[model samples]
Every structure is written in structure tokens, then in C-alpha cells.
Target chain A: MTASGGPAVRLVTGTVLDADGAPVAGASVHLADGPVPLPDIAALTGPDGRFSFPVGADGVYTVACRTADGRGARAAVAVGPAGAPPVELRPG
Target chain B: MTNGPHTAVSNQPVEITAPAAEQAVFEGPSEGAQGGSPAAFTSDGLEQVAGHTRALSESVPAEAWTAPSAPLPDIGEASFGPPDMLETVHGPDDRVQITDTAAYPWRVNASLLITAADNSQWIGTGWFIGPHTLVTAGHVVHIKHSGVPGRDGWVKSIQVMPGRNGTFLPFGAVTSTNFRSVTGWTADGDENFDYGAIVIPTELGAVTGWFGFGSWPDADLLKTSVNISGYPGDQPPGTQWYDGRGVSSVNPLKVFYDIDTAGGQSGSAVYRIHNGGRYGIAVHAYGGLTTNSGTRITKAVFDNLVLWKA
Candidate 1:
């Protein structure tokens, strides 16, 4: 959340799951926007397969998640002024 | 003159005069396809040749085979900041990218295509240091203990292609009649002494300008910016990638930098521009979590380069 006296920025949370709906730990999640630099936000899913990033503004972003052996998924999310909803990415 | 296989001597001048027909054969586009034949040397023969070469390297003085101690300062950790990702053109921070070698004419011809003996293909970067000589990583041409637990030796055959851009072969590939390396790497697998040379047919270097190699003190290297361009496996097979960064640290025989690299870039030249010319100061090898390393050229290595260039 931003410090200024505006609508508070929310935390973007998500979970990574394998094909069998099992939590996928150690998966890499990368978020990027055209205006933002590459790898603007990168995180590894915790043991519970959950991860989060703080977003201050509203915009479209490309989020990609991949496993150690190069298998994973990607998606485009549109964030509103309020914030974005939780995301669940599953390996194909 | 016959184009048959010729032996190489450590201190003697190597002269190769291929027959006109053989030269024409190498000039063809399909030369790379001429590997598999019953007449080609067997794996056993290749191993014997590698053993002999290893013996020759053993004759060198002991002091020439040294490396920097482990646990290097500030750069010793195996894994650091971001996960080490392998991809084409795009690096972790988008700081590194693929290079169009054609734009850099000097570097275009300086790169090479290395084909090993087992026909197990790999992209090894090399640069010409003389009219008939090329410098590359020793492990590219020969890897001990490469296969089954006990079976290990030199590769049967090796071919070099200069200025190879994807399917475009500006300069055709040529097989090396002679290959040389230091005993420290071939015999002991010392990464810090992983340097080797190839003696190609004469006149090739004249067409493609070569880079001068020298050893500068670690102090001066710390103050200079280094650039490395090579064929990384992550990119389209033969394409070259470029990474430039300041020195992170240096030990007696190795140079460590923050430059990005991948598998096939092992033999790339780690060089700096000086006096309006590019000079290679190390043979790039070893990719780590935070930094990459190379064998720092020393006086003994420089002398060996001169000898190989002969």
C-alpha cells in the first residue's frame, strides 16, 4: 500500500498448483508491465504454494510462472483502482 | 601436398598444405555432413591420441599450472539474488541481449563452431590468434571422464567454423589437424588452466583478422570494463550473445565478473578494448549464481599462445 492519502493499494496474492491440484512450491512468478522494467516483480511460491506482490497503481500486467524444469503458465491481468483479485496459476 | 592427418609438435612450426581437391571439398556447404564414415577414426584411436597429448602437456613446468584459491571474496556464494534462468536474448534484468555479429565485423569472424569427435554436438566460441591458430577452452575439444565412469579421453575429431550465423556460414567450416592444451586442464581438469588451441589450414586468419592475447595485472583489470560475446546454447543454436560488466574481483589465476553467461559460452573470449584494439585477457568459463569466471592469462600462458601461433 502507498503512504499517500489515497485509496490504499492492495496486496496481489496467488497460488501455484500442479496438474493434480497439488501445491507447487519453489515455482517462480514474474510480473512485468510495458512501463515497468523487466522482472519488475519476481517471487518464489512458498511451501503452501502462495505468493504476493504489492501493487500501488492500476494497469495491465503480464504475469508468468514456471517450474524449475521450464514447465509453467502465464496470463494477463487488468488491475483496477482498488486492486486485483487473487490468482491461481496451474501447470499445463 | 597430401591432405592426410598431420602430427603437431609442441615447439616446432606447423605447416599444412591441403591438396586442391581437398580444399574444394572443405569449401562446399555440406562439409559438416561429412562426419559419419566407416573410414573415420574409431573412438579408441581418439582416446590414444588424447592420452599422448596429455603426456606432452606433462612436460611443461609445474609452476605454470596454478589457480586462484576457492571461496573468492564477495563472489564466492553459489546462489545469489535472482534465480539463474536460461533463455535467448533476454537476461534476468533485460540488461543482456543477443548480438548481431555482422555488425561487429571483427567479432563476426572471431567466433567459431566446435564439433566434437563423438558427433555429440556443442557450440564452443573461439577467436583467431594467428594466421593458422585459434584459441578456445580445452574442455571443448577434450573432456576427461566424459562418458562411462572409467572411459574418458579426447574427442575423435573437431571442426571449426568461423562467422557462423544460424544457417549462414560466411566462412566455411574446417577440421583441425592439430589440437593443443595445457596439462593442467587435460590431465587434471583444472578450470583455471582450461585453455586450448587449434591449428587450421593456413591463410584463414589472413581473411579474418585475429585478436591479440596478453596478460595484464589484476589491478589494471579491476579498473577496466570487460566484454564477452559467445554462442550460448539457450539462444537459437549458433547465435551469439553479448554481456558487458565491470570486474567483480580477481584472484591469481581467475577473473570474476558479473557478466551473464550460459552453457555453450564456455570458450568465449573475455576481452577489453585498449589502444583502439580488442585484446583477450582470459578464456571465459564457469558460470555461477552471481558471477562468471575465466582463466586469467599469465606470462606463461602468453608464451604458450606465442608458441601455438607459430
Candidate 2:
């Protein structure tokens, strides 16, 4: 799916890290749940282990991430219409 | 757009949808609490047509409706199931991505990125059952609860990408506004009735091929392993993921299984293969820690689907 436009589009961004805090790339990241409809599909971490989702409403959304080999982690963060602060995830 | 004598409803609501702009443009959903008229007929009229259609359909074997373009290679037998599948807890993130998405079966599974009535964008999944017909979770086409006031009605639109591999669209994508669901879901938001359908403006399924679905008996379902493959939001974006396990349990309306999945996979096909033929048993919806479930294909649902296929 293509990205939505307009400068007002707020985003919930973060990076997936290992237990030691090193950036973990290629991990799958998802939102546990959010307002009525979340945008697009889940995010896949880039080489820098970062992922982002476009958000519009305010609520607590879980940034759940998992590695190709089964390691995973999740963080629940409060968000606003403007978006949430960047979160850091560490999969064990 | 009006229909012939067989239907009277106008076509689905459209909003300057290009072949594929995705979420680039936003538009309000069809006005009113009532959704846009169904692609075909109203429930009353559909049932009437189904009466005659069902009689003719029953005579034909399920596989004849739509077979794959050619035989498909084994898309994995799964980590759990009969004879010796080592039935165990299904958590290990073992789902494999399908790069051969241009092939049959895989191509039939479409990734659904949806825009609800509230204009909130979300992700889900869908599968082609006919040249133009798609079966999906009711929630994908219509939002429920939502807490978003009057926006809990039909979705605004859907970007259907069949055989999508990450950003690569082997079959491209189509944005559809036409959709179908029962009163149990649209009116009451009943969890037990969370099944729906979509009809694309084009006959994409004809080239992609489609799956046949039927209401199998409980006894048969218990012995079979249901296969699930869809675009889960947690995975690589737009890529299809798969997992399969034996039916954990079943009721008259729901079929429970151990298929591993997360959000964005709400409408994947829960199918069982018999004699190498794939037929959908359910429309995958709810996902849990240990299990995922779907709306089973019952006789009544079968009839409704037959009519909706038009």
C-alpha cells in the first residue's frame, strides 16, 4: 500500500533492538491495536532496525516486534493525534 | 449504476480511485448509517436468486467452480497435523514468505489495506473465490464498536493486492468500494457472524484463479488440517505469510485452529485440501495467543455466498 500524504500526517516511529541494545534489522513490527483503523500494513525494520506507522488518533498502542529466528519484544506507549514519542524495543 | 431485473441496488460508492493510488487520496465513506447498496442484490433478493442457484450449484462438484491456472507446487504441509505432523504449540514464527506469488493459490490470496467509514486506514486480508468475488472478514468491509461515533458502518474503500510480494505487485492492485456482509455483522456486530465479501470492478480473479468453498461436516473438519496464508501486518509489508494446524475445535458458526497470525490477517482463507483440491472452510478473523478462529461456511452461509458470487 502507498503512503498517505499531507504534512499533518503524524507517525509513531521507533527502532527494534536486541537484548544488548544493538539495532536489529529485518524484524517485523506491528501495533497490538489502536483506534478504529490503523493505516497501511505493519512495518518491517530497515537495516538500522527502525520501523514506523502513520497514526492519527490518540490511545495506547503496542509496538510489537519479532525477529526471523523467533526473538521478540513489545512496548506499550501512549499516543496522541500528533503522534507518540519514539520508542525503543529490545527482543530477548 | 443500476442492475438488471436480478438486482435494483446502485453500485458501490467510489471516490476518484485510480488503478492504484492507495492511501494517497482520502475521501469520506458513503453517507448515512446504512452502507452503500451491495454490489449485487439485497438480502431478500439474493436469497431468492440463491434458491435457484443453489439447486444448480449443488449438482456441480466444488472443484469445478474455479480451479488453479495450473497445478500448484506443495505450499508446505505445515508444522502440525495428521498421521505424523508433530502436533505441538505453534509459536516459533515459522511462516514462510511466498515469492512465487504469481503462481496459483498464492495469487488468490489478496492483501487488504482498508479505509473504514471513519476514514481510518487499517490492514487485513482477502482471497478470490470467483472472477470478481472476494471472501473476507466482515470487519474488513464494515467496522464494529470502534468507539468512533457514527463511523462504525461500511468501510470507505480497500486496496486489493493479490500476489503482492513486499512492494512488488505481481498482479498490480485494485481499489474496491463494493462489499457484502450479513445483518448479524452490519446490524448487531455479532462476533459469530463475521464473514463478508467484496467484488472488484475488474475480473482479476479470472486470471489469478480462485478457491472453491463449502460447508464441510464437523466430523470431516476435525480430521483435516486447515491451511492459512495471508498478509499479516507484522510481517514484511504486503508480503504473504503462511501457517497451518489441525482444527482446534468447532461450533456451528465458528472454526478454531492453531494457525499463527496477527493483525492485518483478518480475512485470510482457512482452507482444507482434499485429493489435492483446495476448498475454503472458513474466513479467518479473530486471532489469539494460542489460537485463531474464523466464520465457518454453513449451509446458510453457503447459500448467501452463492448468491453474492454474482
Candidate 3:
């Protein structure tokens, strides 16, 4: 099925960390199509500072993270339409 | 001296007939009696409103309508840092400042206003949704500390300056004839229900050509692009700004986006273009550094909006 016709099965994973390299729990993580404005998937980092997204029709995707104190960071990863391996994100 | 034309006063009162399911949204004393009752208008307030009206009458021609623009850009795959992260002593560049008003005549329908009540003035943004009805954030019109019954914190009055570009008032300013809000916001302080409306004199919207509002499934809405224009406090007060981006996430009650907004932008219309017409789908309210949120126009909210427009 086409990407829009069904739920996204491609998985992207990452870890969120503070400037000190410590896990930043409760930070918001967003995954969107490459450089495009707006994220298609959003989630909060868990206690272990891990987050994941199931994006559809992924070519290149941007992963962004923002902590409660307003610190933010982002990175870009390329994914296949079928799926991709895990990725890590560190927000300064 | 460019105030358009002096049309006779319609003085037509809008009859709010929200359905029973939506009545709970408007619970509380009538809007006029919320905050210590309406305060007596000061001469300065009256004069300001009059000046605003005259200016609008001269500036907004009767047939003023913004022609449609190109469809929003497609969301492509690329990586960019959050706007806040890019900030340095020099300042942030997330918001694209709009300098040409003629290119965005519809911006005239968005207004920045001060809610004067309890001897304090609070600023917020609002947009025209009908010939006389304006939609804005609920908190813009009323403030309640506890959200308790009979604890209404309604403001005395709201002064709206439409098409305010810095010191210039292209369409003019006016005060609300009435105000309305959802009980979830006024009584419960629920962010999910932070929506409200103001009733203005009919002539203003007639000249501005208000936007239509709608409610669509979140899935379908996610596929479209969204744009918002409003007065941001951080910028020069009264100057409108515009930004458009695809929705980041959406739920039944809220639409999330990365569009940069500031405090004064609450109540700005979060709208999209469909079939060459602009339709509001949410009422912009909250601004987080990473994500800005708006109260989604659900079926219940859409029904209430229809009644308010009627």
C-alpha cells in the first residue's frame, strides 16, 4: 500500500540528552520529513531519554528535541520507504 | 482622512444559539457581567473607538477582498534546528516578517486588542470570522484564577485595532459589543477548550471579508498546510506577522505545529487554504519554544461557530 493509504511502519529511534551529555527526560522529540516545516510525529523522551517515531514515506527526516528549559537540538537522517535503522539525537 | 464610507448603523444584535451539547462551553454569567460588571467607558476609550471607525470607513473599500495565493509549499525531507536554538545575542530568525500589507490584505481581519478590566490592560490577538463575529482565545476575554462558578473574571471591554501595522491603522479600531467563551476555558481553565468570540459592529467585517471556519478529521487536516498571522508582543506592538508550516501533530482537541508565535498572538486564526478559500481550523493560543498549539475546531466547536456566525 502507498504511504498515505496505510499507517507508517518505518521506525526511527533516537536518544535525547542535555548539553552536559546527560539523558534529558521529558523533553519533546519531533520527527518530520526532511527540512520541511512541521513534524509528522512527536513524542516525549522517557526516563532513559529514548524516543521513537513511525514515519510514513520517509526519504530524509529531521529529528528535533526540546527540553523544558528551552534548550533545543536537531539532526537529519535518511530513511528508506520501507524502514530504517535506529538513529541518535543530541540537543544542545 | 482616508476612512472609507460612512454606512448607516445596522445595530443588528447577533443571536447566539449554540446547540445543547455546546451550551456547556458558554456557561457563566453573560459576557458583560463577568468582571465586576462592565466598567463605565472613559472618554478616551470612546474617542479611540470613534477614530478607529472613521479610519476603517475611509481605508477599507466596500469590495476589498484578497485574491488567492499559491498553495502552501510541500513538506520536504530536510533537517533544521529549532528556532530557539538558533537564538544568540543577535536575536532569532524563525519568524518571517511581513512588510507588504497589500500582498496580504486578509491580514487586515486580524486585530490586536487590549482587554481592559479590573483596572489592568491585557493584550491578545483575534480575527474576523463573520460579518460581526470575531474568534479569539478564551483567556483574552476573561480571566479566572480558580475557574470556579460565579468567579467570572470577564474584562470590562476589548479595544480591537484591525489591520494595525505599527502606528498605522489601515481598517481602524473598534470595541466589542459582546463577548463569549467556552465553559471549559472560563470555568475549568482547560487548554483544550481555549476558544472565544467577540461581537463587533457589522460594518467592519463587511469591509474586511471574514474567513470561514471548518472542522475536519485530524488525519485529513494533517495532510494540509497551515498558516497563522497575528500580532506578536516581542515585535513592535500592533504589527502583524505571518508564518506557515505543515502541522507537526494533531489530536481531537489540539493542533500542534512548529510555527513560531509570541504572547500577543493568542487568538490568531490557524487556517488552511482549500479550493482557493481560506478556512480556519483552529484558534491559536499557546506558544511553546518547540511547538505552538491551538484549540482544534472539533465538530462541537464548529457547530458553535456556525451559530455565532448566524
Candidate 4:
């Protein structure tokens, strides 16, 4: 369930990894099973292989990196509500 | 390029070229017949609530060929390896044809193909790793068509179609026993580690050539060149898929090049060129930013020393 009545917006940050452990930068991060990537939400990992997204709703959402191109980590992470911790994706 | 903090290199941007899309997909079959376009998949396509996701497919019309180079400036032509013997277009029934060696030459009997969990819809791509082991992009197996959520979006079923060209082989089918995401991908969601390997139950027919793996961390300093090959939809109509090559970018973190890639080109192998040996390092995943009117970026294998090997 999502935390209502709160003014705080949801913040999600995570590092995408491949089967082996490494930082995958410049990967395309999208909200899985939810809103469209373009307007709804989307981000690319920084040089340090990090990404962050703002969320306002709560549900069983999937975060995916569509292609493992320059970015090596191709994973699907789950994001919760405002008070929840960011989901971690383990590429296999 | 020497492997070091990318910032330490001369800030001057090197003259890199992107492979032209027109020339790459020219002689090959239609993209539609290959797979659906990831660039075109829209938000409306993901509107489904929860159910078996629809399989996305697209055709590559011969007319869609854009010519020697793509309309983009930085784009170049697809690189080729040894001369190939592919020459058939659509098969007799208008379906794709299949051949081993000469008429339909391939290094191995197995051509890597991936499928969704439900198996309602399917897409195909070729792999050139181990005989019983096949490789593909993590996204290919993880993301379903309908935007539906599974038990953690894990793939329920995956089949490898070796010697497949729209026809089933007499040896029967090969099912994957175990699937493992390469370690680099498990650690990061970047282009450097976008590869995954699957262990097949048996050998994929008459296995021809097997690519050997090399270590990236062990690679020498300075610019390193590599050859990339796959069924990029650019081979002549009826012949089996041909191969292409590119001088691997000398840059670190962002290894850009002008290789011929399309929807089905994902998971193709990127080889390190060293003393006449083709050492497999990374797998092809996606196109990069456009550099010239015809050039584009390609994501290849990285983190060889780190990827979880079978």
C-alpha cells in the first residue's frame, strides 16, 4: 500500500549490475509494468553506474534496462511507495 | 585504446563512425520477419493490465534498404569477416530457408534464439558461443511483450532453435537446462555487460565453429580492434547469415563503433582481433548515438574478466 497524507515524494536510486558484479553506466532505466517511459519516467545511469527516479504512486512496479548495450546491467527491479527502499536488479 | 580512467585520455573526440543501417539491412530479410522494433514500441503498447504479453514482431522490407550508408552523417557500412556463402532469399514456401555450410554455411549447428515464458509469441536470433551453451541479451529473456508481471518477471520457458530457418531439425529441439546472467550485468545495468549465457541440454546438431573467450582486464593498453558477426538481416536473401567486423573503439567505458546492427542483431558476439585469432569478448546488444549521417553506436561485450562463465 502507498503512504497517503504525506507530502514527501518517492525517490528511487539503484545500481544496475550484470551477472558478474560491475557498474553499468548509461543504461536506459524504465518503470516496468507501469507508466510509459518517455513522459511517465525514465533515466540513464551516470558515469558511476547510478540512476535515480522520482515516484508519487505505489504498486508492484518493475524497473527494467531494455538493452545491455554500452550499459552492461540489464535488470528488472521492483519499486514500492514513497517510504519504501529502492528495488535492486540482479542481472543473470 | 589504453584501458584507464576515460577522462585521462586526450579530451579530443576521436573520428568514430556509426554503421549505416541501410547497407546492413539491405540484402537481408525484412525486419518485421526478424523481430519487432524496440525503438518503435510505444507506451500504449504497454497498457495491458496483467496477462500473457503479446509477442512483438516486425518485417524488414527489401525496399526499406537505405543504400550504402544510412542517412546519418557519422554512420558507416557494415564490417565483414571472411567471405560468406549465403544467397537464398525467402524459402520455397515463401518462408526462410536453412542450410548447413556452403549453401547455408554457419560455424555451428546451433543458432541461438530466445522465447518468452508463455511461448504465445516468439523471436529468433543467432548465437556463436559454446556448443551446448547459447548467449543472448538479458533484456531479450526478461522483458515480456504484454507488460504483464510474472513471478518476478522471470522467464518460465526458453527454447534454443539450432539449424533453424523456419524449419525444425530432424534431431528435434534443444531446451535450455539452466540460465545464468553474466556477472557484469548482475552488478550494473550498463552497456558494458549486457550479455547472458544459457546451458543447452545437448549439442545443437553439427556444431561448426566455437568462439573462444578472452579477458578484457588482461587486454593490452591502447586501441584494441575486434570483429563482430551475426544474422544482422543484411546477408543476401536466401543464404545463411554472414559476418561483419569493426575496429573496436579505443575508448573505455563507452566503446563506440560502426557495426551493422538491427532488431535481431542483439546478442551477437564481439571478437577481439589479436594475432589472427578471433577471441570472443562481448555480445552485441543495441545501437548507439548517431555520429555521422550514416554512423551509429554499438554496444558490445565488456567485463570479460568479471562475467560469470558457464
Question: Which candidate has the highest lDDT of all?
Answer: 2
lDDT of 2 at A17: 84
Model 3 lDDT tens row, B63-125: 783322211222212223332221110123345455543223344346545433433334567
| TM-score, one value per model | 0.56, 0.62, 0.55, 0.43
The total number of steric clashes, by the backbone 3 Å criterion, in model 1 comes to: 0
- Give Cα distance to truth, residue B118, candidate 3, Å: 1.0
How are the candidates ranked when ordered by DockQ, highest leading?
2, 4, 3, 1
For model 4, how does the per-residue alpha-carbon lDDT over B1-310 read when each residue is reduced to its tens digit? 2222111111114422323232221111111111222111123221111221222111234377322322121121233122221111111111122343221123332344443454322233435454455555544444312222331133445565544443434334676635545323333232333445555666542243344454454234123434343433322211234323233343333333344343344455555434333445555554432210010112223222122222
Per-residue CA lDDT of candidate 2, range B1-310, in tens? 1111112121255421212212211111111122222222222211111212212322467567431121111111122212121111244554656666776667788988776665555678898877788888877887655534554678888899988988888778999988877766766555566778888999888777777788788888875767777887666567777666567677778787766677678788898765445678888876432345688888656655665665
* Residue range B1-310, candidate 1, lDDT tens digits: 3211111122124543222321110000111211221111122221111112222222357488332233352342232323233222233532234443433323323444443443333346777776687777766655543422222345445566676676566666777747777666665555556777777866566555566677788778876667676765444545656666556678887787666665456677787766545567888765532456787777666656666676
Model 4 lDDT, residue B66, Cα: 26
Q: How well does candidate 4 match the true structure in TM-score terms?
A: 0.43
DockQ of each: 0.02, 0.11, 0.03, 0.03
In angstroms, give how far residue A79 of model 4 lies from its true place. Answer: 23
Question: Which prediction has the highest TM-score against the true structure?
Answer: 2
Better of 2 and 4 by lDDT: 2
Two-way TM-score contest, 3 vs 4, winner: 3
Q: How much lDDT does candidate 4 score?
A: 0.36
Q: Which CAPRI level is candidate 2?
A: incorrect
Candidate 1 segments exceeding 4 Å error: A1-92, B1-117, B147-151
Ranking by TM-score: 2, 1, 3, 4
Tens digits of per-residue lDDT for model 2, A1-92 = 11111234456778988877889876767765543233223445667887666543455666787676677787877777656899999888
TM-score for candidate 2, please give it.
0.62
RMSD of each: 19.3, 15.7, 16.9, 18.8
The regions of model 3 sitting more than 4 angstroms off are: A1-92, B1-15, B19-92, B102-105, B146-152
